[model samples]
Target: MALLGLDSALGATLDPVGVVLALVAGVFWAGYVLTSARVGQLVPGAGGLAMTLVVATLVVAPLGAPRAIGAFGDSALLGLALVVALLSSVAPYTLELSARHRLPAPVFSILLSLEPAFAALFGWILLNQDSGVLRNLAIVLVIIASAGVTLTGARRKAPAMSVEAAGTRRDDA
Candidate 1:
């Protein structure tokens, strides 16, 4: 709702299909994070990630292979593919696995919400895509919301931990 309101305030109309796709992506990302955390617990991090990439490649191959074969004739395109794969997939997945081990799920999810702001910044810097003032304001709103969630969550957890500690001490006494 806030996102929709922000879009309207920015004088941008939402495409229904794009909105639906974004929602669907959010669901998939939630699933990914939860499953990755479990997988990180059960299997060696790199091994599990290796298996995941292999399965992902197999799944994507039918659609991507034929197009890639045709496109791979261009050496520059091949280089771009390799760089994109490493930068977008390899580095991020590895870091995400490490983060999943360290961060609580809710906090992690809040952190994930900052991706759009980073994307906007990267687009501006790397692709020369300029977001106007209203759009930049929308990005700032997202960052503030994420920070609010994270700080509130941390405060909530601190009390719970202290309560647990008191309970343990009482039991020992």
Candidate 2:
């Protein structure tokens, strides 16, 4: 609903194909989170991430390698690619794997939803993309929502642990 409202505010029509692609991306994201968490539990952090990246590169290389090779002649593009790989791929995966070890799956997933809000802020600041008040407010709301869930969820677990500890004390007594 917030998306639809934002779209309406922007005076933009929704593209069905784009919406379907977004849905597909969301499903893939969910899969990535669940699989990453399980993998993080089973395998060591950096090793699992390195294996995942190798597989991902192998999967994508056939399609992208030709174009990438052609573009490699440009030193600026090569530098950009290196920066992108470090910032967008390596850093995030490392942090995400570490987070998976520390956070519950649902909380991590809720935190992951903050990506769009951060993306919007980056786009506005970096790319000079849409600076409309409504769009900015929507991004703020997303950040607030994600933070609210994380804080409230963490608090809820505290009481349960306290209750369990209290029960254990009574049992010991």
Candidate 3:
């Protein structure tokens, strides 16, 4: 919605600000997940998530309606946003961070291929953004292809004495 508003208000098809927002979002999210896992190493379960939300709320506070807080107090849309945020942002972040600590990056990335499917399912259920069978099948195919790459890459036998301690290292033994 924010992106749609920006695109419409600016009369822009594609713009740097939008591109930058997307890039920054992806970069920060990747860092947030990886760093959250590291922070978990230092803290404990959900501590990193709590800290992330604290910082994120601080950053987004000014952008959220301060004066109209009472307006959203009983809004179904606001409630939906809160629920979606919990599921899409908070839950996924924690799960990905925890998984990144255990799974190889390629494996994790491949596992993330399922994200679109879940998102689509949620969109259909939550927002009624339903798609036809062909579109859904296409999405499934893409996910399967991505998973194939991840699985094949993870299964590759790497030579010994090659940065074995890294999280991305293969357990080829």
For residues 90-134, write the lDDT of model 1, one tens digit per residue. Answer: 889988887877887767767787887788889999999886666
Residue 2 in model 3: lDDT: 43
The residue-by-residue lDDT of candidate 2 on 52-104, one tens digit each, is 89998899889998779966899998999989999989998898788877887
Question: Any runs in candidate 1 off by more than 4 Å, and if so which?
Answer: 1-12, 72-76, 102-111, 159-173
TM-score of each: 0.73, 0.73, 0.55
- Alpha carbon lDDT of residue 116, candidate 2? 73
- Per-residue error for 63 in candidate 1, Å, reads 2.1
Steric clash pairs (candidate 1): none
lDDT of 3 at 47: 74
